[model samples]
Target: MAHQERVVALLRQPNSMIAEGFAFMEAQFVALHEDIYVAQPKGFEDPVHPNHVYKLRKAFYGLKQAPRVWYEQLTQYLLHHGYDRGSVDKRLLVKTTRNHVTIAQIYADDIVFGSTLQKYTDDLVEVMNKEFEMSIVGQMTYFLGLQVKQSSEGYFISQKKYAKNLVKKFELESSKTPRTLISTSTKLSKDDAGPPIDSTVYRSLIGSLLYLTASRPDIMFSFGMCARHQSAPKKSHLIAAKRILKYVRGTIKYGIWYSKESELSVTGYCDADWAGNIDDRKSTSGGCFFVGKELSIMAEQETKLNFSEHS
Candidate 1:
């Protein structure tokens, strides 16, 4: 019911052309039902039946065709207005004019839109409001649990608040912070002789860190290494998990910063050791990509540029 109301509101907003479209549809339905029975199927035998209700003249809320009908209607309107749907992501609508371009992303009832020029953005909003009943929330801050921090330099996305909540949820407030993600000397093994811990807790910690990796690529290798032992995690695996949490505690404020000066150029460096893992005797590969010269230097300094250890 709520969904239907929302769709109807979008069609009935002031200055909306959808009203005219709806009227046209209603007229078509009436013309189609002129000779056909307008009452319930069972009541069609009795013309004077008072309890008989009129059959639906147009797509109704519970009808299976409702979504398709609405989609066709909206798509036709956008196509007429010069908006093109993205090939890969259909929810993305783009409109490019002589001086500016506007993009809108649709996620069910929510929308995220941006533009290269303010006039274009405003024009889109006005047109949408004229056709749909929508409330613009203005500048976006948090969407789908990602905390967006936009700056003149570039956008910085993180989940600091979500990380804090996770820390509290796991009761890791008393844990000591670790200096490094993992110790070079410590080697984790699937030890049959070692003591076992709660596999559920170990898996939960890994899951949390996996999500943190969205903005904290520094821990990707370490997390991937620890994830291999989730099937029968031992004390050593738990220790590694705690180490990652401690690292998070120490660097909660850390995040990736996309600079405005950054170009579209993509460069990558890969290095691996002969046999970094003692258990499987398999090599550990590490690599990082850069968009600009600044990122290349940063990656070099942080990764140590040691091909021997990485290769």
Candidate 2:
């Protein structure tokens, strides 16, 4: 059948019948298991004696294919029940009715979804719960490390707690706040003359900062510039990172707010710093996109800019 026809058929059925069908389908796969295996040298010896490699009979957490298998199973189930995958975002599924629209987002085993019609959303949760061993987390608060707050005004998503944790992890909670993430007059380069520091520590700081940039785009450009010198980070680079931490400590509660009154139109803003890099004389460009007033995307690029003295 055509995709639209299939969806119409599913919607025409009584909700109770559809719910029961989903229940039966879920039971069939509840006990299905996949095997796991590990390889070892044939002559490998244990601490007490020689031993052979073992093959696991059931799927384990660390197996590479476990997530893929689970997702395939879930996607098949949803498709069978009339949900159509979104063209723009593969992780999204859409089900539409004459008066209502429903959206379901899949992130591995976790699901975040909503519907314009309360009944449709309620029916969906009922069918899904009947089929799979699932946990409904109520309204989405925190998912995938982003803190979500839904209010009468709209929705607010932030990483304030995560930012605070990052500052504490790096022992920068007590550091003095900086006026800015990066100094406007300062330029960073691969400092060959600077002494080496612990690469592991530098890398860890960079990793934490990178994650923080998800909600804190203000420091994105500075963090990216400092990250480039991770292989040979110097005192200067470390200071720059510490400055970011100081900024975080001072503004830990700052976060993005999405208002209900905001328009859905997408708009973007771009700015560039010409010859921002001292040694390389590279210009840095930064851009942020908004759907209404809520930020939807942010990016930064570093470009080599030629400079010459004029007469």
Worst 10 residues of 1 by lDDT: 15-24
Error of 1 at 126 (Å): 3.4
lDDT of 2 by residue, 1-311 (tens): 23323223332333211111112222323322555557655557465645555566534444566556656766777788888887656776777778556667777656777665568878788878766765555667787778987665666678988988888888887788987888888787888898878989999999998988877877888898889898889988998888988998898877777555665466889999888777777888889887657676788888997668999
Residue 210 Cα positional deviation in candidate 1, in Å, after optimal superposition: 1.2
User: What tens digits encode model 1's per-residue C-alpha lDDT throughout 70-184?
Assistant: 4555555667789887775676667766645566666534567766566777787777666655566666777766787765545667788878887787888888888899998
Q: Can you give the lDDT of residue 38 in candidate 2?
A: 74
The candidate that achieves the highest lDDT relative to the unseen native structure: 2
Query: Model 1 clash pairs?
Result: 271-310, 272-310, 272-311, 273-310, 273-311
Q: Say which candidate scores most in TM-score.
A: 2
For every candidate, C-alpha RMSD to the true structure in Å: 11.6, 7.8
